[model samples]
Target chain A: MSFTMTKHGNVVVVDVDGQLIVGNRQELKQKVLDELEKGERKFLIDFARTGYIDSSGLGVLVSLSKKIREQAGELRLADLNDDLKTLFELTKLDTLFQIADNRDRGLESF
Target chain B: MAPVRERWPSAAGSTGDPAGPDAVRLALQLEVPTDVRLIGRIVQLVSRQARELEFPAAICSLNVPVALSEALSNAMLRGNKEDPAKRVRIRVMVDPAGLVMEITDEGRGFDLETCTQDPTTPANVVREDGRGLFLMRRLTDRVERYTEAHGLARNVVRLTIKRPPPADGS
Candidate 1:
């Protein structure tokens, strides 16, 4: 239900705490869009603390990815649990985003 | 908000219980306004009930929450159009076989065949909206939609998830 932003080198890591679904998806979108407006382009969404994400959460991620790409920026995701990994795979979004094993790897990749 | 309504089946109807003849079927029903914020609480309630009924961890923790959230949000946003006067009715039945949930929304039904597009398709991957139905179908064992015409016409989404066979092949 919370999104915490931090900077590591050029990557702006957004850590998602708690489940991401319809109720709070708009907050996440606004936060990321605000960061995008500030010219912070390289983004990594860390999901280590995230319990789960419903379809609305996934939609926001897709929308954010598209927006970031339009601005010539990149977005990556890391630390998704097994269930979440399966979700991305099932939706075929695994191919659309660059996913890393952890935050460290995600930062390095950027 | 109106209080949740629950109904339990009588013991005499347990003749074909999946667990045993003595098993009692559990049911929970709720009617909430068309609000997205209530999705989490409802999901938690159903998830806890599934766990208490000895459903598998995967189904209790992930599948049920994700699929139920989708169904509820769909009912609130698309079915009911976020009408404040409208309400979403949820009924859950849990037995040893699995869980069955019915979500009824007070709205005219749409054609699921025409509305639900494959979100995985290359053209639709970035659409950001059409994946709810796809995820619900993929995560649950069954997803069915139908319209009820008694009084006000409404749409019902019935989802089912069955318990897997025991590991020892029992």
Candidate 2:
């Protein structure tokens, strides 16, 4: 997986591409946490290039969300395609985080 | 010499029969672009075929297939090891009285229980990994991992979704 980080004031937009699975979970989680530690509470993970996600991917998201929320912040997922959207719904995670259809709409919320 | 069979149930009312001796018809490989719709399509196929052999929705086989698909994704594409073109072999069959769903991969086999994915805990839900196996256990009646007799270390996973008793009052 490839990760690209871009900062928008307090919002850190992390763009993930390719398959997000077990092998890359540690590096991905650490990157998110490192940013979270710097008080960048709001996160917008754009899945524009992400093809697939598995258990490890989902777990890291959940853990990171908690980490951010604990610091009085929020985490949002943007541009998740229908496939990933169904996964979120099936797992009932669509109810927990703030999911938006596009990046502009997602970042604009905060 | 009879082929090894593994069986289990699902959580949804997925009516799939795994008896009567009919074998599963699964494509021998992973055809890229693993999306939710494709996953649902495969789940539907498994659910339909399993129900045909009498393993009806008494165990929610629908969710079980999802879990299997998750495992497939992990074993197939997660290692930057997408070279040589891997194929995920899925077979569904019954032995004596057990319903089995088997997925054989062309990659190196790994441990299942040691995985650290937690879908129930929302805090860890968005990490991009770890939820597949987590959900697999939650939605299926039972899940087990073992090495195939051929020494291929194939991940022999199964879901024994039971069916409701006949309504004839017999």
The C-alpha TM-scores of every prediction are 0.91, 0.53
TM-score, predicted candidate 2 vs. hidden true structure = 0.53
Candidate 2 residue B133 C-alpha distance from true site, Å: 4.6
Candidate 1 lDDT score at position B141: 81
DockQ score for model 2, please? 0.20
Candidate 2, position A84, lDDT: 74
CAPRI-style quality class for the chain A–B interface of candidate 2 = incorrect
lDDT of 2 by residue, B1-170 (tens): 99775433332223554444464332222243323224445545665655565564533243444565665555456521454355555665433243456655555566777775555565654444446666667655566666666855555555443334567954
Off by over 4 Å in 2: B1-69, B72-101, B104-155, B158-170
Report fnat, model 1: 0.67
- DockQ each candidate and list the results: 0.79, 0.20
Task: Give candidate 1 misplaced runs (Cα > 4 Å).
Answer: B1-20, B149-151
lDDT of 1 by residue, B76-141 (tens): 998899997999999998876778888999877777777668999999887888888888899888
CAPRI quality of model 1: medium
TM-score of the second chain, each candidate in turn, equals: 0.85, 0.59
